[model samples]
Target: MNTMFDSSNPASAPRVWEVGALCHAIGDALQARFNPVAVRGEISGFSRAASGHCYFNLKDAGGQIRCAMFRRNAEQMGFYPRDGELVEVRGRLGVYEQRGDLQLVVEQLQRAGQGAWFEQFLRLKAKLEAEGLFDTARKRPLSTMPRGIGVVTSLGAAALHDVVTALRRRVPHIPVVIVPALVQGAQAPQSLVDALQKMYLLAQSGQGQEADLAQKSPLIDCILLVRGGGSMEDLWAFNDEQLARTVVQSPVPLISGVGHETDFTIADFCADLRAPTPTAAAELVAQPRELWLGALDLLQDRLESAVQRVLDRSAQRLDLAAQRLGRPSEQLSRNHLQLARQAQRLRHAMLFKLQRMTQNQQALQAQLPQSLQRRLEQQKQGLERMDLRLQLLDPRLVLQRGYALLTDTKGKPVTQIKQAPPGAALKAQLADGAVDVVVTQPRLL
Candidate 1:
């Protein structure tokens, strides 16, 4: 405390000063006196500006002091503050010259007496991280354009409304299903688990009966877990270990938008994608209709070019084949000439063979007649010779030459006559005549 002029000491007339000078001096004094203080109070009038600066009042049962947290400082604090939260703020105590108000330029803040929740959060986080649950390698990738999307949030939540509006505007044809659940309160975590299971079933089954969609044709491609911004206590349901594990094990990809951009929870790390807001999540899952149409047009142009090139190639091939083919009429004329030559040779060979066979038949006919004439002459000569020999041996000729013959009455010729048997009749024969006689005696002569 500067004791330059003590009004209690009755100093000769107190030092007169302008209001601006007085305020400046007080500010300077306050800045120099107290620094790096820890003020325990309940938060009130808490609000964050667009510049990321935080403004609030710290109060107890008796009085309150104004506070300001700059964008740079509050950013490092890692959590947003809400009204009526008991907190201990660390800052430099000072006075604002313009408003003549005492204030605290906050550097950091801690939630008063709720260290156990933070500790539990850290423990579960450590366990999951050790198990590689938050590994980027293990995370699933969201489809570029989901067929259908499922959402798990309170039906009355403003987050749901924002998400629907964004999705419908982007892709009016894409289907969106709401898996309603309590997003806060004691039953919130289990509700989240059941809702996620139902969503996964809906995705795998490709059925809209349980997912509550109009058509059952398209499958659910991704799930969104979203809620509006709230204090850490209000958002604690998302920090449940079971819920985080369920998100990690989801059948389809999951996006977490639980709370504002500055707020985060265990669910955010476990999800396949983390969106800053529900509207952002919806945008990530859908593609604009105009963009899709433009892409299709480009592909159509490429296809037409390829087909034309193929057709040109085919026409060129057909022309080459036509050039390679020869005239069929010329080929047939050559074949006809060769066939005529072969037929002439065949006719000459037949005539020559027939003439040779005729000459051989005439020679055989001439030999047959001569052979028959020679055989007839040989037979006639043999007959004439035999006749001559028969004439020489004739007995009539011998009789004419004085030869005589005798015969018995029996008409047998007898070279020796024993004189006929006594009383037997006999005949004596001359060459020309014969006489009969009777024998009186037998004699050998």
Candidate 2:
């Protein structure tokens, strides 16, 4: 102003470091104008960088903020933000010194309202619902009396206990199988889908020692997808379009009771049956004990009636037989005297039969001894004849009649002269006794 205050001072002129620091401070001050701000706006201009960073804009009626989300933070969010989707952002405002661009380092991004999420839900629901997923014709009717009931719920959730208790009260003997799963939050949707698939496969495969499509270790019959009442946000998992489709396509009839009496989800529309609450669902699947008891009473009455009918028929038959037995008359005893004469005639007829039998027996007895003596005499004569023939054919008798039989030392008959080998021992049957000799030379004759 006055020629550098009459004396130019290097310190007062500002050092290079101080000038650089001043510029940086001014940039920071500009950025501070928007720092630590909560911006509610629909996401736009979203781009993921090659460096694993996300670039997006948060814009509302008033203004917009450029947001950058690192890969680490972006991966943690359940839903990916798209353009025109309402989202809330929390970040620190900053300036890129080189580009001179204002930027926000996003620490959080969430749905601003039911606007975008509801719209997406509707779109998906319509798409799947149109595919017959929500068709009433595709739904399976619940068995009046299910042999077993399967429940899908979070293990520690109170809804599980409510369902179990309700089912037990309605039908105590029906077995209840619990397939534990997460029913809320990011994991809830997939967990529910998996559980539904498992039950469906089990029903399709039938009772056997084989695995199903889900490859679950244990099997089940029918499935009950249930959860306690909660806010729309809390029940959002069941509202998932994929989960709803799974429930609708399930082979096993699925009962959906995802919330309280007032609560409903997309799954409710697609399920085979929708119950207002978990307990109600359980009751729907189980048979009422009172009805079964009444049926038993009816059966007992029928059995009693049948038994009585049988007994009455048997009594009637006995009375008829007794009446027949009491009427044992033979033409009024053949007019008394005539009946007595007939009785005598029957006795005489039987006695004649006995007398004939006795005469036959006596004839048989007389013939027995005569036939025996004749047989004995004939047997003696036949023996004498046989003895005479034996004497004629006997070798001893032949020897006594002066005929001799020559045999080899081995008792072989010397029928052929060649059989008597030279120098072999021999024996001859003379009229008196055997004469032992030696085979010298065979006389061929």
All candidates' TM-scores? 0.55, 0.45
Per-residue lDDT of candidate 1, residues 116-166 (tens digit)? 676687788889999988999987888977878899999999999999999
- Cα lDDT for residue 233, model 2? 85
Cα RMSD, model 1: 41.3
TM-score of 2: 0.45
lDDT (C-alpha) at residue 304 in model 1: 39
Top TM-score model: 1
Query: Considering every candidate listed, which one attains the maximal lDDT?
Result: 1
- lDDT, candidate 2, residue 292? 71
- Model 2 error, position 276 (Å): 0.7
Compute the lDDT of residue 77 as modeled in candidate 2.
54
For residues 20-116, what per-residue lDDT tens digits would candidate 2 score against the true structure?
5665776688666767876778888988888878998888888887778988887645455779978777777776556656677887666776546
Error of 2 at 126 (Å): 2.2
